[model samples]
Target: MNARTPRLEEVASLAGVSTATVSRFLNNPAMVAQQTAQRVQAAIVETGYLPNLNAGALASNRSRLIAALVPDIAQSIFNDTMEAMIEQLSADGNSVVMSLTGPDNRRLEAQIDAALSRRVDAIILTGIVSDLETRKRLKSQSATVIETWGLPEDPIDVAVGFSHAAVGREMARFLHGRGYRRPHLVVPRSGRSQARASSFAEHWMADGGEQPSILEVNIPSHFGQGRLAFRGLTDLEHRPDVVVCGSDWIAQGLLVEAQAAGVRVPDQLAVTGFGNLRLAGDMRPTITSVDIDGARIASEVHRILRARAAGEVLPSSLVDVGFRIIARESA
Candidate 1:
């Protein structure tokens, strides 16, 4: 015969506390006195009591569950933000469920539906929802929707991000200031990367520089693609004097390939990259890159959720944390 499943009442009895007190402690430990909470925790462990979160959610009308959707987990750029957000949410007694939406709008919509069916309190998106129907459904839902990585002109509920176009334009100006005239951009075909590439090209031309060349690589750009991009650029009759990459991974690949080909960095070919990842500074001639504060974005998301939970209205729905150019040896 199987042992009976432990009960909440049994835990309360063992802890010398009422069932209501046990329930309060389970829902929010901060509500109970420290000593009492410790006793309740000890009793819970002894009885192996597991609270039914579904029942608690029904009674409280809040799931304390958050769903986070990202385009690609293989891209390490999202790691910092995700780690910080998960840490903050966990501290608040909330659990996070993550899903990869990829490039398909239908897949994204289906994931949202699944999260809603579970009665999640909030939905966090790595990027703005571009699909009209999906946006409408999210706007209609009671869940607090937050978009990160890029600021949308019309957010569903809240947005925390910087301007991709601004980053591109600033990079172009920075390169121009360093006297790099013949520049080439190696970027992924993704939407955000394309946005930056377009802005960079426009800004470069407007600032009296020649029309910059562009090479569109596959999405989720890798180091190999960067090396391939370098070869392609070098094969051209008019080789570029400088190369700007969409990511640090690509930049690192290019740097390694250039070194193998006996090309002096900066002196012969200047290089720059986006996302000031650790490798950017650690690599041999260090890469100049764009810096986005992933932690700040996560903190803003947590702040908005906390404020909403308290029934407080924020002064603004959009929070632009901004980006900066970290000039290093490569540029």
Candidate 2:
């Protein structure tokens, strides 16, 4: 309790243990003897020492702290992926933490900066960071920088994501092959949607299909937007026979809207979505779209970190978890 004493060091001294031993006890409790750990804990409580964990991590050269940063937690796709990764990674040995960066902001860069300041063991970032300074800082820190959700041209370290371009190209080919001449696109103005929407438009035009109408909406909230787009699309001079969405929830809303108007799916207005979430198949007619396997994404990210920690050289910068075109009654 001395005013001049260092926090964790004071507690360690009070427990008759070296600072390194106390650090190990905090990072890996299994390495410390029960009696010694009890003594350290008692000393910590008596001295009111919370331990400068960041300083301890810097001195040890390993934090054993893994952080996953998401652009927005409100998005279900990321919610599922992060949930799976956290549960699985925590089960193995690492201490996993989360940072919810507001959707489509530079918050990811700031969070990554903070993580590097503490020298976290691993950092999994969802979505792309476009800043050059940020990339340089990331490379300098050289922490296990993993880009998830959105694939980057040059990953800071490793990447795990489905190709939005491929998904778009495939959707165009699928609906066009089925003789749906008019397939309009609905996507959010953020994240992967921009890529998906732009690629879909490009590929659809290149495939000799008409320059289909495009509508942008707030993503991860696509269901309600889909409902609104449904009426908008149907009222067009030449109504779209098919609708491709940035997410399954969006497509589901379109289907629900069509049904209420007694419009038969596929027969009248076809619907398709991306992400192929768990509930996609449980819908009345089962949503048909590109399936991005969330579980697989989680596992790959885990392996990347574990492999690096094992001192194994990873041969690839980006690992593609390919998507499948799941055809259902919708399209």
Candidate 3:
């Protein structure tokens, strides 16, 4: 014979609370006193009680779940933001379901459908939603939609990110201020990188500099791609004085290759990179890169979610958590 499942009434009896109070606490702990909530939680653990999420969601219209969609999690660029977001959501008695959309975002729609079917309370995306039908569905749903990493002119609900084009323009000015005229770019063939590269080239030309050379590499960039990029640029008749890279891994690889080839960084060829990752500082010569504050972005996301839960309307739907250039030895 098998043991019977614990009942909600049994939990209420153990916690010395009414069945209605137990139900309310289970649905939203914040609605009950902290001391009472603690007692209920203890009783739940002691009784091995599992709340029926589907039934609770139907009653409260909230699943206490957030779905996070990212293009790639292997890269360190998104690590900090994700870690902070998960911590915050977990503290609020919410669970996070993450889906890797891959580099091409081909799995985005499917992931969204699955998340919606589960009645998630919120959906967080790493980039802007581009699909017309997906955007419309997200907007119509009760779930709060938040887009991160890039600021779109028209967000589905809310946006928290900096401008990629601004980052590119700032890098161009930084290189120009350092007196590097012949600059070359090595970037991954992604939308964000392409935006930065385009802005950098346009800014460089507008500032009376010659047209910079560009080399597009594959996504999920690694140090090997950077080394190959360096070799390719060196083989050109007009060697660039500086190389701007889309990622720190690529920049580090190029720096290593330059050292092996008897070329001095910042003296023979300066290098700059995006995503101010830890490796950028630990390298032989520190890399100059763009730094985006992932923690602040996460905090803003949590704040917005809390406000929405309280039935508060924000004054603005867009939040621009800006970026800065970390000036290091390489540049």
Candidate 4:
């Protein structure tokens, strides 16, 4: 006959404690005395007793699981924020599950449903939800939801992110102040990027400047798309003096293509990027970009989620992790 699995009651009996005390120790060791904790640990080791988390979850109605949704992690733009969130959540005795929903609303909706079915404690989304069905489904669910990256005017539950429009205005001001006449924007074909581009154009045009040249590519863009954008921009009748890219990858591509085409950066044409990636500084002519502190955003998100889980009254449900304009030689 197979040996029966040691139960929590058996561990408590061996450790000279009540079953409730053993369960408390398993859930939160700090709540138990040091001597009692040591004894329980020893009993667990001796009896090889493993806590049945599923059984505990069933009793408490808490899965202690978090699900995070991202558009695409291929470029690893949100890796720092994700890592920090996972680390902090793990410290709180929770596990994080990630899903790549890309840019499709259907895929995102499916993932959201999957997470809900698993009874996740919370759901972390990369950006604002535009799909009405997905938004409705999220709102109807009981799980805590947090939207990151860009602040949505109407958040599902809680929103923690920076303003993309603010980023655009700041970048425009920075470049215009640097004496750039013609400004052009190369961005991804997404609502967030388009919103930023609009803000930038409005800011530039409001100051008696010419209408900025704007171009966009499909989502999940790469360095190659940046090269294509640069080619298209240069071929235009009125070539831009400074170009702002949606992401650093695109700006890097622009730089590489410019070097190949004998275009002098910041001399013949100034260039800038967003996200403030590592390669932005390593390039021959470093790229100027916006620095959105992903780690700080993650910290704030974890704090809100943890507080809500603890039934703490929060001062506000919205948090804005601001951005900074990093100046470099590229612009």
Say which prediction, candidate 3 or candidate 4, comes out ahead on lDDT: 3
Q: Where does candidate 3 clash, by residue pair?
A: none
Ranking by lDDT: 3, 1, 4, 2
Taking all chains together, each candidate's TM-score versus the true structure is: 0.92, 0.81, 0.93, 0.91
Q: Please give the CA lDDT of all the candidate structures.
A: 0.90, 0.81, 0.91, 0.87
Please report, as a residue range, the 10-residue window in candidate 2 with the lowest summed lDDT.
Answer: 51-60
List clashing residue pairs in candidate 2: none
Which structure is stronger by TM-score: 1 or 2? Answer: 1
Between candidates 2 and 4, which one is better according to TM-score?
4
Q: Give the clashing residue pairs of candidate 4, or none.
A: none
List candidate 2 stretches off by more than 4 Å.
1-59
The top-ranked prediction according to lDDT is 3
lDDT of 3: 0.91
What is the per-residue lDDT of model 3 for residues 261-328, given as tens digits with 9 covering 90 to 100? 99998899999989899998999899999999999999999999888877899989899999999999
Q: Look at candidate 1 and give me any clashing residue pairs.
A: none
> Residue 14 of model 4: what lDDT?
98
Model 1 regions more than 4 Å off = 9-21, 29-39, 103-106
Model 1 agreement with the true structure over 162-206: per-residue lDDT tens digits = 889999999999999999989988988777888899999999999
